[model samples]
Target: MGLERVIPVAEKLGVTRPEAKVLTVAGTNGKGSTTTTLAAILAAQGYQVGLYQSPHIYRFNERVKINGIEVDDQVLVEAFVRVDQARRDCQLSLSFFEATSLAAFLIFQQQQCDVWVLEVGLGGRLDVVNVIDPDVAVITNIGIDHVEWIGDTIEKIAFEKAGIIRPNIPVIFAGQQALPKAIQDKAQACQATLYAVNRDYFYQDADDGQHWNFASSGSTLRLPLGHLALDNIAAAIAAIQVSGLDVSEQALVTGIRNARLAGRFDVRQIAGKTVIFDAGHNPHGVEFLLKNLQKFMKNHDQYTEILSIFSMLGDKDINSVVKLLKGCILKWKIAELNVPRAASLAELNSALHTENNVEQFENIKAAFESALAEVKDNQIILVCGSFHTLEAIWECLEEWQ
Candidate 1:
């Protein structure tokens, strides 16, 4: 199917959208995390939840899951068949993203999901997923990404993300974005109950290293996840409370600790080194990941060297992302990601700034090999920059070991 076919078919399918409550997520970086967190929280509360995310690094089925299990391949294929046939009559074009978005929505309808957590694939206003009106809308930390499709300024982008907030819906944001008042006006126009971080709910890391304190208008609980995750956790908890699900603080803490969303700072063992992976596409996310990685490294002992395996698409703010991770990256093994929009080696080099300690590889596997050959025992080998880089290395690591 094509982008044109995505909407009409989705609109037709939505006419019979199954008996399911909806919680929509729209943002720049934290959409997947917040969606996964809410899915886990609701699943722990004994509700059958369906989650839909985008830009899967590993598999197409990663986009749709129920209670953390990827929807069966058979189910996905059949749903795709229906959507394909539906579009055949119209002969409409559908992008890869559009087709997958519609298929997943249809699958959610087929399954009797108690709650559906949907993340906008791109800008909220025109995104295929926006065809579904979400009950509880949550925007997590709006930042600059998709500048061309959305807008140039943060306020313009926020306006688009804020489009998901429907009338009378209580929209819980992770924090007040550094955007113009136009964004606030748009949310007010939609009649969404805006609750920014530190306003409707507040979080403070306790002086003790054990736990962090999270307080909302409804309730407060000391969370198990660290500060980096509190914003996401708090957003999930706030949305759950607004949903009136009666999920307990114990469930929140347990779910937060147990929540393991892949491709988000996923750490694994490879060739006796700390193989860290994060799919931080844009600069904002890269900044956050670098900050967390530094803190994590500082808190740990016996780290020898930092080797980075990096690649990115042509579209991203590659320079900023690379610069953020470059200072401490003792060595760089640049490679090509197996993706259509991959940035060439020359483009990747622009981010390196200094010419020293950099090497080029045919692909991510080659880069990983180079890094592995040189790294010390127990040293960190971070495979980051883009999902394509991490995804390629992730697949290769299975065969390497």
Candidate 2:
């Protein structure tokens, strides 16, 4: 839960501070999207960029990338060997995440990347990503997630997320709610100038919906929308603007257009059905998912019924998530995920007790198969609830491919 275990190993591995400009992003929901977009923008400006994110969708190689491409297997293996030897020399025990993160840092340093954009795998203050001081820090948003490890309330979580702030650096808080006192206090103590969304910078969808605008005190630019949510893209843009990096406006446009994240409203035509794969497990995340789903239904009015293939981790707020989607989702096809913290069938059933059109299956694959078999031309199938759920479906669909 703290960096005490990783710092010594990082120092031994010589990745405590690499020779590269660093930007660290911490939050519950949008860390992946924000980091991906930030890396894309840096790469668009012709900088060699290294992006490190967590909880890969389909492959472990997805966690580390160079200039928008996943690093090769041999590179990762060599880095792992070095990281293992370093930890052994330090007489320290590194968790799986700690070892993998150190390896990613080693790869970035060895490649001599111009910039490194790191995403916090959990709450920020004690995360391994905090081992290196970032030139710019961005907090995408804070929510009541990972309560066991972080905290139970918004303020508590905010305090942990604010741990990434450093003295004299630009800190960006992009939460839609009012800035938490803990974050404000931490930033003030660090003497870091904090730029909050809506207060210091703002983003709004343009009238055409095909483009959006980002405006701060000094500059304004209208850019094309990407596959990700607008708020996340806006946060990435704000981080880059305050980063003081030599990035042109065209690079921003090109990066925004090229940035794509899997399982964040990822749309695909699979098995003769329009399926949307989203990794929204908490209430805050589900709210964003609902917003996107509503807009999609509005544009494609032909989709009358929405069928969902959903499963979640046991520790999540299942009832609230179900409440959010039950109204829009006409039918639910649920199963227990094959993960350690997966919610059992009893838990999912108890949460969905009020719903009438519920269908149970053996596993996530069967649930997805049922949804696809029953989906019609006018209906959409949504695979969501957890990243594991999406992984299960992707693995199953790989055979069809």
Best by lDDT: 2
lDDT of 1 by residue, 115-176 (tens): 88898888787777777778888888778777878888878888787877778877888855
Give per-residue lDDT, candidate 1, residue 79: 89
Task: Name model 2 segments beyond 4 Å from true.
Answer: none
Give the Cα lDDT of each candidate: 0.79, 0.93
TM-scores for every candidate against the unseen true structure: 0.94, 0.99
Q: Which regions of candidate 1 are displaced past 4 Å?
A: 1-5, 15-18, 226-228
Summarize candidate 2's per-residue lDDT along 1-401 as a digit string, tens digits.
88888888899888987879999999988998999999998999999999999999899999999999999999999999998888888888899999999999999999999999999999999999999999999999989999999999999999999999999999999999889999999999999999999999999999997998899988999899888888899999999988889999999998998999999999898866799999999998999899999899999999988999999999999999998888988898999999999999999999999999899999998888777778889999999999999999887786555
Question: What CA root-mean-square deviation does each model show from the true structure?
Answer: 2.1, 0.8
Top candidate when judged by TM-score against the true structure = 2
User: What TM-score does structure 1 among the candidates reach?
Assistant: 0.94
